[model samples]
Target: MSEGFEKCHNEYTLFTKTSKEGKILIVNLYVDDLIFTDNDEFMFLEFKNSMVRELDMNDMGRMRYFLGVEVLQRYDGIYISKIKYALEIL
Candidate 1:
C-alpha cells in the first residue's frame, strides 16, 4: 500500500526504437509501482523485449506494476485507481 502518503502520483518512462526510428515517454512512479497508457501493441512488445535484452530483468509476463491500484485495460481505454490504498487507510 501507499502506507502513510496522502497523495500519490504514478510515474514511468518508456523508449521505443525500431530499426528505423525512435520515441520516448515520461510517466510517473511512486513507491514500487506504476501505470502507463499506450496501445501501440506491436511497437510496445518490441520495446519491452528491448528492455529485457538490456537489463537482466525477470519477465513477469504483463501487469508489471499495479501499485495497489486496479488496472482495467480494454479496447476502449484504461482504468486505474488507488482504491486499495484508500480502503487500507480507512
Candidate 2:
C-alpha cells in the first residue's frame, strides 16, 4: 500500500486513505477477494494500477452482486437491494 494508506485500527483487512481534497478511498479484503471504491476518479485509477502492479489480481469491473446483495450504480447515486436473496429463499 502506498500514498499514505493506513490500516484500520479495528479491522486489519480494511485500508483507507483521504486525499488533501477530502476525497476518500476505502479497500476491504476477504481472503483473496478485494473490494475498493473511491470518490476521486484519478485516485481510483491510481490505486487500481498499484494493486495490479503489486498483485496477481484481475479487474472484475463494477460490482453487481456481493454477499447476496445486489448493487445498482447510477449516475444519480448507488442503490442496494436484497431482492435477489429474498427470491432465492422463497
Over the stretch 1-90, how does candidate 1's per-residue lDDT look in tens digits? 211112323312332222334333222344443323334565556545665687664545545237477666666766787877798899
lDDT of the structure predicted as candidate 2: 0.93
- Summarize candidate 2's per-residue lDDT along 1-90 as a digit string, tens digits: 567989999999999999999999999998889999989999999989998999999999999998999999888898999998999999
User: Which lDDT value does model 1 have at 49?
Assistant: 69
Give RMSD to native, each candidate: 9.8, 1.5
Q: Best candidate, TM-score-wise?
A: 2
lDDT of 2 at 82: 100
- Global lDDT scores for all candidate models: 0.46, 0.93
Shift of residue 68 alpha carbon in model 2, Å: 0.8
Checking candidate 1 for backbone clashes, the offending pairs are 10-28, 10-29, 11-27, 11-28, 11-29, 12-27, 12-28
Candidate 1, residue 33: how far the Cα is off, in Å: 7.1
The TM-score values for the models, in the order shown, are 0.50, 0.88
Candidate 1 segments whose C-alpha is farther than 4 A from its true place = 1-37, 64-66
Report the poorest 10 consecutive residues by lDDT, candidate 1: 2-11
| Clash totals, every prediction | 7, 0
